[model samples]
Target chain A: MQPVAPSLRRKPTVMSLLARFAWLPLCFVLVGCHIDMYDQPKYRPNRPSDFFEDGRSMRPPVENTVAMGSFEADSALFTGRLNGELAVDLPMELTADLLERGQTRYEAFCAPCHGLAGDGNGVIAYRGPLQVPTLHNDRLRTVAIGYYFDVITNGINRMYSYAHRIPPEDRWAVAAYVRALQLSQNVDADTLTAEERALLGGP
Target chain B: MSAQIFSRNANAILLVSIAAIVLLIVGIISALIGLYLSPWYTGVGDAIEQPVPFSHKHHVDQLMIDCRYCHSTVERVAHAGIPSTDTCMSCHSQIWTNSPLLQPVRDSYQTGEPVLWNRVYDLPDFVYFNHSVHVAKGIGCASCHGRIDQQHLTAKAQPLYMGWCLGCHRAPEEHIRPRDEVFNMAYEPQMMPIADRLALVQEYQIPVDGRLTHCYTCHR
Candidate 1:
């Protein structure tokens, strides 16, 4: 069957003209303007709001509730202390894997600031105003392994805290690595293993 | 008389309208698909303005400074952190203290306020990526960042879409490198033979499976 002629069809009225604009809104709709949860209403940290009584988005911890994973069973491992005194021994076994992990972590974290040899000559130290101390100093050599851990976890004078940067296990590994670095610098020929002594061109 | 006018050249008009409608529909569909897939929205290789005008091309390429010198916490933290104003003062305090190029940095130092750097590469809020994890797992900075040493003002080097992310996550062994080379921006994979590189991946213990391809690997 033939379609109706154009003249026979109804002419576009003001209503039809208005209906032609329906696609304008449909274009926006088709573009997917619906808000994903990613863009949902949110309070960023440090932003103040009238909704909260404190006018702060950041909330303080409850009076007595403990944080998850806050309870560390072994203070020696986490804080480098045993019986309220700095521990001399490592809490974990000294293995090649641990040292390898330590070396990688040290290169990534400390090498830029402390130098690979712990000689206080890292690129930042030589160039920056901050004076980094050597790990092989007489005082540091005498300090307990836990003392190093404490300084790294809490950050001593002129240093920032690595608590957020380094994990407890990695921190211990770093302490062990530092100990190894200290031992390497000031080796007594009398105390060397016979195999090691041979490598030093000794009889 | 009206019917005769309407009938005149009606076949030609119908054919033209039909063709025009088909072309419009095809164009719309193609445009929608292109918007989703194309690099136009990704802003790949487009230079972004930052507050300090710091140039990785100058620092990494010319000065030959290691990537970790500035982004020091990359291997230990989630974010490949921007160096602090104090970190900048380390060198610029003496060298270029009077230069106008470093005015913002000097201003930030004097006021004890952070120089708010304009971020070039941004992921969706839902995608939770950790720099430390990727660094430790043996993926080199070059794999995702492209040749950043060549960039004067950094831009998003890749599409950063879900499919683009999945492409690498699917076969990470292809991207994983030696741990020492993670911060080596100019490092090329072909430096070592293919067999040696593959062996390095296995030695590094990078999972050769879909563990990283899982949604939670990135989202969580």
Candidate 2:
């Protein structure tokens, strides 16, 4: 090869490099615009409750928010409907079928903490750290059906609402069963009649 | 010199063209195969057969019985569970006593065993699905489960996947109705117009965000 003159010789400098790669800047701009279209914050499902609303009450009302049925002045009967306005009517006689249904519901929803025999020594209460109240106590016996229902539905202190798990009718049935448990254990000796004593296999 | 430059340029262009053509062919073939085989591509299907041939078509369509009659827990539980043999015996013992079709159910009742009906419209095990909540909110069975009443063999009609559920959960008002009309599609239009329904969904703060895609909601 023949040697060229020094004045005619050229080199690949920064200006030449820029000229060769001029499309890079435009390419980056195009890609950036495409990504920006979809860069907005996405929608999230199952967001946790915002707990910082100090002005608004954290819990629902006590009376209107009973677990099962609330007593209404208009009708003299306990209604199972969610918002039905009906009066509380105590049953004249407790039925076996009602007790059976109540037992089933209680076992399914409450027995984990409130033991099968209405004692507070359930698996969750004994094994777990929580202290559940025994239904066999005198105080619990005096508690009204509506009050029991309210506690189950709204939860008193540490307990969460079983309303989502157990239906409204079943809650009433469970309450009825709790009442039956209280009656069976706390029956007064004075109230026992000759027929009752005979039925009880007494002298 | 001009001829040499023309030949080099032509050779480079030809090489690039061949590479581009090969990539195009491979991409097209793979895309087609993916579309056919992948559930992610085409959604879920219910081609798998159950142990017993339980026909929703016969039960729901021909007989005009409701879906809730058999899958009784839909309104109250997370699952719209398969009926126990006892539930079947409630009607089957008197109605289809001698029919050959009732043999499996009769056998189940006699043996104290339940039929393990194959789930067709099952979501991923992680999803916490409550039939009652959906039913209570006025979502129709047909909305996600498809036209199940028309399906004789109960094939899964829709892809009951996360995206599929989020589509409605994010904008429930559009699909919601009064408690009674929750299962009734016909009652939707009469209850509220689509625009009004969408507005109500927005107003009630119905979750539309895909955040429900969290692992615990469905998986747990």
Candidate 3:
């Protein structure tokens, strides 16, 4: 073999060694670039769709169509009316559990405008500077139980329909709670026993 | 020794180069870890811009509306449903009827077009999280979302890292609360005793057989 000069032998200097591993850092940096699995090419719930004209990933049910097993056979459960007039009685048997459910539902959906006491003193009513009708009034107190359900299902006056927020059964629950509230506020003092009066903290 | 081919500084350069390489590797790794955890990368506190600048503080805290009133399906389904325009109008039709801030909502209502909301807690597609199951098992809204009732604009509270999730899944008793308090934003996990939480884990039938930590639990 011909003798080669040390200069031409290509000594592995610090710069050469550094250059050898320079591509290593690039590997780490590039790892973050491929996030295909992170965000897949499929539509998630409410994800905007470019293909749809409205850009909604969730398509609305066809007009005048109801989902399977969702349709209520009892018209009164849905409309809060029977034979075209407001049903005076609850469609389902009223139980303590139902009343409790009603109380919670009312506090959540109705109490925001229809005060906790149903006197229309809810926080929203106060802030709305709008006259939300008191549920304790003569007409409201005398109205059929289904009347409250009807009003909630199809809003009266300034009230928008809460059908979207509160389901039909929940609307009935709120109605039942409204009745309970009316009864609570309208108790005749003379009818109470001394023990009951003592419990009520009233003379 | 006769030729003196190498310079004295060569050893110094070699030592410094070795130290520099070690430091470079350490520095790069540290930078990557730091960026991964940062709010900029993780979007932990980023408040996404919505067409309507709805203040959760105003609606949830000040107004005292229930979280379920708006996110209606949180207890019933996987997705904590965004309220429809009508849910907004249920109050807006009576209140804030003319605010310029609610113009997009009004337009959406009138046009029958959905208001495009920017998602805040966008988890990766591979992971399957069910809001109903967690809610039923006694995880509060604030557990993962933080004190959202206090946030003027909703922002991400958790980084939603797999390790953060496994931290709880591996031992859920550390975070579980009463089923009733699941909606209470102020309720803390520590408020309930460890014994009670363990009891709830049993009562709620939360699997403690390492099934929660299994690969298919979330990924599938």
TM-score per model over all chains: 0.65, 0.47, 0.85
What does candidate 3 score on TM?
A: 0.85
Predictions ranked by DockQ, top down? 3, 1, 2
Give the alpha-carbon lDDT of every model. 0.76, 0.62, 0.89
Clashes in candidate 3: how many? Answer: 0
lDDT of 1 by residue, A163-199 (tens): 6557788888888888888888889988988999999
| Order of the predicted models by TM-score, top scorer first | 3, 1, 2
lDDT of 2 at A184: 73
Q: lDDT per residue, candidate 3, B84-160, as tens digits?
A: 99889878887888899999999999999999998898899999999999999998889899999999988999999
Question: C-alpha displacement of A125 in model 2, angstroms?
Answer: 50
Clashing pairs in 3: none
Best by DockQ: 3
Residues A49-143, candidate 3, lDDT per residue (tens digit)? 99899999899988978767655645888889888899999988898888998997888888888889999999989998689888887998898
Alpha carbon lDDT of residue A71, candidate 2? 48
Candidate that scores best on TM-score:
3
Interface RMSD of each: 6.2, 18.9, 3.5
- DockQ scores for all predicted structures: 0.14, 0.02, 0.48
Is 1 or 3 the stronger prediction by lDDT? 3
